[model samples]
Target: MAKAITQIRRVDPTPEELQAQSITKIIGALAENGESIIKMLDIVSQLDQTGILDALDAILKKRVDVAEIMIQQMNQPTMHKIMKNGMNIFKFLGSLNPEQIRMLMDGVGHGIDKATARESDDKKTSLWSLGKAMKKPEVKESLTMMVSILEGMGESLQREKDHVH
Candidate 1:
């Protein structure tokens, strides 16, 4: 534990490293795995359209949609930064006793990661851009869906932060 702390103290990654080793990659890897499974099942779907339908699952079933993932990771980092400001940290630390700090950390710490938030925001950015890019029904539907999902996600995240405290 002590050694881990010393290592953490010694090496705060640069922005590039942080971005390079982010959860976007993990999500992408997961999406890629999903894509392979989808591809394996594509033969069946190609043979029958009725077998497969639904925007969310369909999109996620594809290989690493790098552009989409990139957008999400990009948006998330900004929010994490905003939340982790020195002043905010000090205030947060001050408000909590030792037990509260432990509890706050536990609440915030879960499976949640900086990349998740940024990537979600990235999806929103992608949707806005997507809406601008096309004049077709499918893209319009996708863009609209993305807008609703991303906006709802952002609101939920904000509310989680607000209410959790």
Candidate 2:
């Protein structure tokens, strides 16, 4: 006859053993994150001492009511118009090229500097001086650009009207 080996049975932990194991795991975690837990506890203690925690709780409790009131206000016509105008302004800005925007800003700054210099001089330009300035290539180019922009604006307005109708 051949000898046979018996299979071993597994044992479940007792309630006391389970509780001790849980405590051990908790202690291990606390040891690993001791500093972080202390900081969190300090913050919570400060919040409680200052009554900020109660105020925050109160705010959170009435969040739905606050949201409803905000919604009601935002639904008004003036709010709608304000939001629409803000969105349109953003869309307009978004449509502009970055390089062109930079150029426009630079031009505005240069114009401001020129105006300040002119103010400090306090000298009035004669008709002859104005005529001579107008003949400059830079002035001519600027006037041409202005005229083109006005023409483009007129065309765009006409298209918008046609679309609306």
The digit string of per-residue lDDT tens for model 2 on 92-145 reads 999999998898789879978998999999798899999999999978977897
Residue-level lDDT for 69 in candidate 1: 80
lDDT of 2 at 80: 93
- My TM-score estimates for the predictions, one after another, are 0.21, 0.61
The C-alpha stretches of model 2 lying farther than 4 A from their native spots are: 1-62
Clashing pairs in 1: 71-122, 72-118, 72-119, 72-122, 73-119, 75-118, 76-117, 76-118
Query: Once model 2 is optimally superposed onto the true structure by TM-score, how far is the C-alpha of residue 10 displaced, in angstroms?
Result: 9.7
User: TM-score winner among the candidates?
Assistant: 2
